[model samples]
Target: MYSTDRRERTQIQQLTSFVKAWSQIDPATAPFLGTWTAWEETKSIYPSSVKGRVCIIDGFIPNENNIGFRFGQGTVSNGRIKTDSYILIHQGNYLGGVFVYNNEPGIYEYAWPKPLKNPAELMRRVPQSDRHRNHILEQFQNAGCTASRPNRR
Candidate 1:
């Protein structure tokens, strides 16, 4: 099993690498993201607003429903966006990951399921209880997702 600390470190490393890559892009070539934009000094993991929008550059885990949801204005503060503005990445029956919520109009959510060793076998093991199913469905929906039924094994 992977330790949470290890996972967090890996995530941070990945984000740092992404920021480095973005730094190489000339502002003249990609004006959409802006030339002044860069990762925040305090939170090197977060992408700073280049043109009034926070860009999410982290790579998402496959299969896990990683949804991004908006909770409206006043959600952001102290140069940091509100947690509700972002979607919580779900790992199995628990919350495992997250990404910044954009400032775009209307609440947007995304859902992705965790990668499975054997998709068919995992599907077969899905609980038959309506309550369980409903709970899972609700989690994904609340995060602005409707479940991700990916075809993979």
Candidate 2:
């Protein structure tokens, strides 16, 4: 079993490596690493479904409240990347997963889509507490995006 620190370190390394490789590619081919959000949501666990060891790195982009982008990277399920799809857990209580590129051997390039015309549109639709709101704002700030008051809402 991998320790939490080890798992986190591995994830960070993978993310760093992915970003580096992505940067090397032309802007037209590669996606921009714009103002986005991330979180360490899953814990390291061994699963019977998977033949070997595995770890889940689950989180959403733009922010936690906006959309769900479940990304997993580990040697599991007979050394396969086991996951159905990127669950869009925004619209419905249980939005069906969309089959994103599955278990590709190379590094995963998960990039955020372009910003919406009205950022507050997402915030207004989702039900968020004050703490969640502030946390999301902090994430935006960390990504170098200024968070303005939701005057449009």
Candidate 3:
């Protein structure tokens, strides 16, 4: 409605695509979702492009009730996707340390992100480990997250 290219479109397309991808989970890894879940919903309050796709390599792990920690967003263009963060927090550890990873795709290859440092120590230790991860989840919820199918238990 506005211009062909705008900021709102990017946000909508990115969020929608993210929710879709997150809904389609790996059956094998579904049971042990610690933090790497991306359950979300997206809306176009202003109008944005929904043609392209959004791909999340690694970052935050969201669960049915936990949003987990995330640092950045991914790039959505021409139905292709890429990440914007060098390191992403996939999940959290009991020690309040997050499992950090890097999804450095080279030359548009289907290269998955590797664990740069799993259980990366957090700046503030969490007396209750679940609380640390829950904090992140709440942030996304406050962002007016859209509803998606639960990926994990």
Candidate 4:
């Protein structure tokens, strides 16, 4: 399908870039990849103004959601995924954030995009994220999500 305007084009490009980066995540961090919605409590505190937002980092452009211009690019590391924000506006001005996987609580806390009082104060995966993450795990190999998840939960 053809993009009818510049915004749509940019969105498509962002999704394309997102897919490329996400597919390479090392298996250990693969479980964190999915759609996420900010918990009600985090909305006001989130610097990105992500309150009431459903974030889909599933590497594919969603037909109904928008993740804006920011996308993730990072390597899978021990207990955390260090991600650099692929920002288009102020290129090198901001620091990248880290996503820490809390296995016991079954949550992923993202720190930064600007560090607040609580360093890891960002996002709690909702049902959509759970479903999407599980789907990715199930079809990881076929979906080209390169990383082979090794029971990191």
For 18-129, candidate 4 gives per-residue lDDT tens digits of 4345335333432333322232212111111121111223222333453221222334444333435321111121122223345332332221121112111121323445
User: What is the lDDT of every predicted structure here?
Assistant: 0.27, 0.31, 0.29, 0.28
Of the candidates shown, which would achieve the greatest lDDT relative to the real structure?
2
**lDDT at residue 104 of model 1 (Cα atoms):** 43
Clashing pairs in 3: 9-48, 9-49, 35-61, 36-61, 37-61, 37-62, 41-146, 67-137, 99-119
Ranking by TM-score: 3, 2, 4, 1
lDDT of 1 by residue, 11-101 (tens): 4454344434444532211111211111221110122323222332222222333221111211223333334434322223222223433
Give me candidate 1's TM-score against the actual structure. Answer: 0.20
Assess every candidate by TM-score.
0.20, 0.24, 0.27, 0.24
Please list the residue runs of candidate 1 whose C-alpha ends up more than 4 Å from where it truly belongs after superposition. 1-7, 26-68, 71-153
For candidate 3, the per-residue lDDT at 7 reads 31
Predicted candidate 2 versus true structure: per-residue lDDT over 9-93, tens digit per residue: 5545544444345334322211222122223222111121222322232344446454432223233222233344432221211
Better of 2 and 4 by lDDT: 2
Error of 1 at 67 (Å): 10
Off by over 4 Å in 4: 1-26, 40-67, 85-153
TM-score, candidate number 2: 0.24
* lDDT comparing candidate 4 with the true structure: 0.28
Top model number, TM-score: 3
Global Cα lDDT for candidate 3: 0.29
